[model samples]
Target: MLLMFLSRFRVLISGLSIALFIVLYGFFSMRYVPLSIPWLRLVDFSFWILSLGSCLAGFLDLYLFWRKSPLISTLLITIIGLSITFFARLLSVFYSLLMTSFSIQILGGSLIDKESFVITTGAVAGSFLILGSTSIHTIYKEPIIFLKSSTLYDLMNTLRNTPIVYGSVRELSNDYYIIH
Candidate 1:
């Protein structure tokens, strides 16, 4: 079990690290280097990479669900969702900043407006907050039951072997008594 846990932990860490590296590299490359590739293509490729990473993390979460506590599983899912949402939003901000900087370098004035950035960031934050609250509420409201057949049988046996306690009794008459 320990070996299995360590292997899964390594996989999770490596996956997140690779995803972070890709996002950083992509952002820096887009911002600093001038490539002949179209901006739309770059955006599409970045989205695809981000989607793939999210999918991989989701699969890993599902694969290890049974081994983890329900609370931990719920937290992992929530964190993964929030991280992906944050990264995607960050990438959008980085793209916008790069565009604004590039335009300013060429035009001597900022062509990009701040309203769009503000709106986008606000919307992302609002949605993330709503999602997080709902997820946590749902997770706490639901109970986790991981009982196996053998475990159920053992529980029944143990319950059967336990002694039963009787409450105090009240005497009604010589031959009649009531147990409370």
Candidate 2:
């Protein structure tokens, strides 16, 4: 039952993420204006907006559904999302430096330019958030059954008498024995 619920929730998140991305992309693309600083370019602001929305969705999911400390899980997930963005930016800088030092040439001379850097960073962060929020790690917990005294004794006796058992024993809550 819980698995089914979570599976549906994941699908809902995926749909919402796509919808949000589309809206943000349209808004940013239409209102984009060239700025002096390349880093502040809003041409692809949709990606950043999508990434942030994903992270916020993930945080809310964790905080609401998480069985442990909701606050801690929410905080940790948020921090991890931010850290991913930070790492991606740092890696882009390193990549730029390496490209300048080496003679590696692709379609263009500069690979990790400012525009690509923002796009890549936002994409990575957004992907992480979407995945983390939708994917759940859950421990299977068995339900406990309360059996009457006579039924319990008979069940135990039958098990004790059956010596050569080739299969595992599973007791149903009701008083029915299914033999194969």
Candidate 3:
């Protein structure tokens, strides 16, 4: 029931909400003295929207995975990486932290300008987009080949069918499976 509702209305709601945000952002950015809001506030709100959308998409991806559709995860992650490229243009705390942590300077000079930042962002995002996508495609194509379990193979034979997947674990040990 819930899935049906979501399937029918999700796209409509998402489109409307994004449109509403753009409209509100433009309205707030206008030079009208009485209605104007801070640019930083608008940016913060937009970031929150992106974060929330990514999280919800993650949850939906998990549900879809159980239904034997694992492709959504890769698509969502790629989209998220692309969004980060756009957001990196802003002078946000995350961008500052990355720049400071990595010591990214302009050709060994002190100043870091916009062009260098944009180039670095694009390079990193593009590399991940390419490599990450191929890896995800491989994993989805044949998950069990990587699991490497003869016992799992025997169990599948006993059941007379091979399951589509058995996902990764944190570590290969008895301790890793303990709840506490």
Candidate 4:
């Protein structure tokens, strides 16, 4: 049962793991990176949003995985994850650009300015690293193979055979209408 669940949500699990790693790395590495810009708050906020988006995407993937049709769900989840990653990358790039511009303006393109550019570029690169790792892991993981197991196959068949209906009935003019 545990294996089945893991296989079904492997993509989400792997993606979350990568995101966690990035978050942890950023947390620990922040001490070493100098904060000269006044707008560091904005960068921090963007990073928080990136982390939140990754987590939400993971949950969305899990929700879709349990639905009746998983192939389409998987596709949708993949697209969502990719989109989230892309947005995060863009945010990071924007943050980096701001940092670069600030550094150049204040430092007159000195060694400090170069350092800021490197730091910002590295931050954005880290996001891409997470995306690449998650993509590779998702591509190689065999979630569909789990569906072939006898137990899972039977369970899915049973679920498909069952019909779920929810409705409120209203009577008007000697006729009843069901709204679901």
Candidate 5:
């Protein structure tokens, strides 16, 4: 159980770190130069798509997580929604930054020169797909893990010691013996 939590913790932190780095890179670069370069029009579209996807995915994730762990209903309803909103916005920025970088690489053009619109769009879109994929995968796993790892699983197991969580221990033991 501890190992499971630790692994989950690491993945969450790593994903968040990468997301933060991408967002920072985007904003910092924009500060020095305007975000809209003529070549990078695609980047804008990609960011928009990414933004939309994040919002949708976040809502879906929250709903599923709530269904799995109804105990955290209020927290999930309010805080989870906020968290999803923040992630969606952050993801769009990160996608833009990554796409911008990729576009520069593909063009084999001098990084010093600003790119045109199309290159930006492709790059931004690509970035969104990459980052969004990770988020989608994590969201898919969260509910399953939370539902299975709840105190209910532990309490269910403890019932084995009492012969109450399920039914009669003599019958259970006999069944187990017969199966073995």
Candidate 6:
């Protein structure tokens, strides 16, 4: 159910909510205007939306992995999902802190010169950094191989040692090896 929403609606909502939160917080954090409501109130909704999206993504990932691995998929998804949530919260803190710090400058009779390009580029880079780093780490670790047992390793070895693949790969004569 959650995955369905995430795959379809949750992604858009979370992304928009995060963007809205960033804009609103960035606005208030830099200016420190008197609020009729509260300071950074929009952030609460954004955080929840982001958390739900992360869990949905994680659950769907586990479901896909369930075919090959019942245990490892469950564990990795749970752990990584939690970690993503934690990191998102940290980024939110960074956003809030940066805004608040800038607010003092604005209040001190300094003009807030907004650079549209810089914000867009920063957002793109930050998104890439967050997503790219996690993906690269996952690829380097090759966690899927770890989920395999000794039996699977032996089977893979058997396949790799087959004459067709061996001749193509090693370019060795049949007499160089023995088949018992």
The candidate maximizing TM-score is 3
| Candidate 1 lDDT by residue in tens digits, 1-180 | 654464244334334544564675477566753333343334334433444444443333334442343433343444455455555555555555686664432111211334323422332332333244333434454213333222223334544664445687654335434465
Cα-lDDT of candidate 6: 0.40
Off by over 4 Å in 1: 1-37, 66-68, 71-180
Question: Which is superior by lDDT, 2 or 5?
Answer: 2
Candidate 5 Cα outliers beyond 4 Å, as residue runs: 1-36, 70-142, 146-180
CA lDDT for candidate 2? 0.45
Give all candidate RMSDs, comma-separated: 17.2, 15.7, 12.9, 13.6, 14.6, 14.2
RMSD of 3: 12.9
Between candidates 5 and 6, name the one with more favorable TM-score: 6
Candidate with more favorable, higher TM-score: 1 or 4: 1
Question: Candidate 3's error at 64, in angstroms?
Answer: 2.6
Estimated TM-score for each candidate: 0.31, 0.34, 0.36, 0.28, 0.28, 0.35
Off by over 4 Å in 2: 1-15, 22-40, 65-82, 85-122, 125-129, 132-180
Best lDDT goes to which candidate? 2
Q: What is the lDDT of residue 62 in candidate 3?
A: 30
> Clash number for every model?
0, 0, 0, 0, 13, 0
Clashes of 3: 0
Per-model CA lDDT versus the true structure: 0.41, 0.45, 0.39, 0.44, 0.40, 0.40
Q: Candidate 2 lDDT, tens digit per residue, 1-180? A: 665454445435544665776775556545653332222334234444444445555544444443333233323453465456545544544575586675533222323456545534555554465455345322222111123233324445566765543465444336545343
- Tens-place lDDT per residue, model 6, 1-180, is 665444334234334545654675576556654332233343344334444444444444434333344243323534454455545544544454466574432111122122211222233333323233234324443223435333323334544775554334543333233333
Off by over 4 Å in 4: 1-23, 26-72, 102-180
Cα displacement (angstroms), candidate 3, residue 58, comes to 5.1
Write candidate 3's Cα lDDT for 59-139 as tens digits: 333333333433334544544644553444333434544666755432222114344333333423433442353345345
Name the better of 4 and 6 by lDDT. 4
Which 10 residues in a row give candidate 1 its minimum summed lDDT? 104-113
